[model samples]
Target chain A: MSVLTSSSEAEGEAIVLASLVEGTAPAADDLEALHRRLELAADRDRMLDLAYTTVDSPVGSLLLAATEKGLLRVAFAVEDHDRVLDVLAATVSGRILRAPRRLDRVAFELDEYFARGRRSFDVALDLSLSSGFRQVVQRHLPLIAYGHTETYKQVAEVVGNPRAVRAVGSACATNPLPIVVPCHRVLRTDGGLGGYIGGLEAKTALLALEGVGAR
Target chain B: MNTKKPFEKVVAEHGPTVLRVCRAVLGEHDADDAWSETFLAAMRAYPELPADANVQAWLVTIAHRKAIDVTRLRLRAAVPVGDVPERASTLGVPGALDHELQDALGGLPDKQRRAVALHYLGGLAYAEVAELLGGTADASRRAAADGMRALRLAYAIPERTGAGK
Candidate 1:
């Protein structure tokens, strides 16, 4: 959570945060029934117009964050129920509402992606962050495909600058799209795994899944 | 310029945790895609994350959705994941239990399942889960304990590597 210097802003944020974490929110039993799920993250009044999602994903229970603009955040290893809600309120000034229909649609699409090596998603994206070089990085990231590894130099080459290896790495390091762009597929010229923005292990795992060379 | 905010820092720091969660919930092959998707989803909107939000819980929610979504879709389109066992299936559980453990875990209500898996697999404290998930500490405890109880009842056969080994 950002350090709130303004007591009023802090107080308002706190109230919004408190409202988000007001109660006991749990996922529904039916894996497919995300819409019926109501999380006790906040009071009924607080989640008035927010997008509510409790997705049964590969990673434990995932709580998706979205607004009319599109998905805002995706949390993992959900702990500290109150803190989570507070963070959400702080992110978007408007009250956090739990509209299941809005989030469930994203959940359904994500389900398809995981059920296999999903090459595409039907969910509309906000893509607000991918601009300039970041957009360039995202555009080239996915072209690496599954199981193929390219050195930073190679990525630079693909980006049309064979000499800009380090720059390419930086672009990749800050890549907005990790999977759609397959950043894990990027590697060093040697067989060694390159540094991953997430971690080498995750990078290795992604490569392995695509049957990339694993030593 | 420390342009990246706390939520972004949270994503960078806890990327593995998110990936691990996805793997545990989704499966190996699909976990990476889900993990990437989770972050991609986060990037698009994390810039505007509420100042006081529980970053971890937000990520967990994403991981959970992406993992389940991809896994379910695979179940629909690919050969059923079924009961095929692999050497690593024991995961660090020491006990060589069958997929029944996962099946029982899968059977749990979402909150309970998350509590158990986070505490057990992810090695998170109940308090941590509570804060991220925005639940009372006691509530997190119950969900985790209840999940364990259900697994015990469902499996009945001791840890396949059975008893303190």
Candidate 2:
């Protein structure tokens, strides 16, 4: 059957409409400024209030997130930025926005650490994501010293559960905050590099950055 | 399965399109306010939104409501003003040809304007546009067609000799 309306006429209308849309589109900078203003409004409203930013590191981009309380999560690029954000949305608050100023201290500390100018992170941390034994394990992980290593069994004993070596490995494997918590410092009792949440290569690199050789 | 991503990704992906729709419906001066309000509302309600929900459609819907509110506010504010010549030159549409198109668009009836904007700029289907505008799909399609025809007539220019027509 023949169409009543001419196809070319409809096509011309579509082209004109498309051009009208293009000509009226707002500038990129305007949109960015609008986003910044919206972010400020959201922050002032104090709804859930999780802010995040990305930092470049020797390994790759790190997603750093924080709350009003303190720095919350630091994730590696391998974890996938989307997935990491989803996790943050689920565990912390879905009210997440990328406001880099909130993570300034974390980024600065990370930059210093990567450049070998800082030995330990000084930012406040929110450990609500970890609990009980895992929390205990993570709390002790940073005590491993900047340039030293600890066996899984030693970590287990340090947390007051010497026989729970496998549990210590699990804690390290599931550490909510990895590099900041220094989970990479825990190794197998046989002096071999153990599993790291950031991957074995990242763990080795971190150890190398700390002037320790992963055997 | 419903999937969710960071709100940043959502904004980065859809900000331009939403801004275009806002500018089309509200003009440049008020579009920024409408855009800001739409995203603020969306961000506030984002967590409760189903993961399977059409994010762009959802955003456009919020924008539609915000646009209506902005239009109402602008109309209310227009009341106390003295007679002043409208600043045609400062209209947000960039080039001369598109400026004519925009002027023609502004002259259309309200239903036709909303129908054309939802269908063309917001990229909604006839049925969706009808639903948003509280009309039948056939009615929405007719309004858009009528608006387009009017635009074509209004936007036409005389041919120039030895120059691109």
Candidate 3:
């Protein structure tokens, strides 16, 4: 069982070979540059099925993902960016890369929104992650004006299903694009802060930023 | 229970090792090209890869085919050259070329070099190496051992003793 003869010794050989190969593992920046090059190539070839990047926001790190269609999903730090990426890889397409260029517009919009300089997101939306009633609920969420708060009941009524208030709440809870889709604008009928996928502080911050004030 | 991680995670974890294998097989100048091609192809097909598949081995397999393609392309290009010189340092990934080790690796027979590189640098098992290079696991094991012994002798890698066995 010396390090040479066994198949398990392959790892041992890697340990020894790591030093002898091209001095050291090409510095991290080198690999990153190579990765970026690959991202560009993939993009040029139209093979980049999903591209994502993170943006620092008032909420926390926001992971923004997009497809060729448009902005696909927006997730908060609480959602675990890695796990969210994994879910994206599994369900949507594993042809995903952290190519920030695709999300530049999304990040810019978020920055403007958080700075209280923008009223609504003007970016294209890819509502493919939601369908049926959920998709309809998400599509209607953006119409609830920036400074205005819509109760779950009101949103349900507007969506032509007044009996589906709790359904609307679930739709808001599961809204794939939180800030950009404006799920934070929907509230409990009593005006108590409702559930937010980005967490309550984020919801509160977003509403405050929009001049809704804390209820 | 979707356990598949992002392709970015796959690249982050396995990128270096695959780069080493590419460099070991095709030297520095062409290695990055092979690596870029390998990952791009892998990324394209990654959605269909089984969740539990061995990603490193899968990547090495792809790298091997890309390396072969690069070698064939280089042969066809036929820019006459002598020994591959020590690379000048560059802004991007400094090609800290160890010419002696590169020469020793280049001196090896093709199968032996491929065996050593795929098994050691690429971290593929003997069976996987056999699948790539087309021989028995035992044969890949032997070729890798022979290649390593030759490399150690030529490059004068000091034999360590009594660390653990």
Error of 3 at B85 (Å): 16
Tens digits of per-residue lDDT, candidate 1, B1-165, equal: 112343333543566566556545543345556766676566555546665666666777777667656755655565546663221221223221224444554566767766765665555678877875567989998887776666555655333221232
Q: Which ten residues in a row have the lowest lDDT in candidate 2 chain B?
A: B84-93
Query: Candidate 2 — which residues are off by over 4 angstroms?
Result: A1-5, A90-93, A213-215, B1-3, B82-98, B157-165
DockQ, model 3, C-alpha based: 0.39
The two-chain DockQ for each candidate, comma-separated, is 0.01, 0.37, 0.39
Isolated chain B TM-score per model: 0.54, 0.80, 0.83
Kindly list the per-residue Cα lDDT of model 2 for residues A124-168, writing each as its tens digit.
Answer: 999888888988999999888999999999888878999999989
Estimated TM-score per prediction? 0.38, 0.86, 0.87
Number of clashes found in candidate 3? 0
User: How much lDDT does candidate 1 score?
Assistant: 0.54
The C-alpha stretches of model 3 lying farther than 4 A from their native spots are A1-18, A21-24, B1-3, B80-94, B158-165
Fraction of true contacts retained by every candidate, in order, equals: 0.00, 0.46, 0.47
Q: What's the lDDT for residue B27 in model 2?
A: 68
Give the alpha carbon lDDT tens digit for every residue of B1-165 in model 3.
445787888889999989888877777777888899999999888877888788999999999999888877766576556864332111123265466666777777888888988987887889989998898999999999888877766766444443333
Candidate 1 chain B weakest lDDT stretch, 10 residues = B87-96
Higher-ranked by TM-score: 1 or 3 = 3
- Model 3 error, position A50 (Å): 1.3
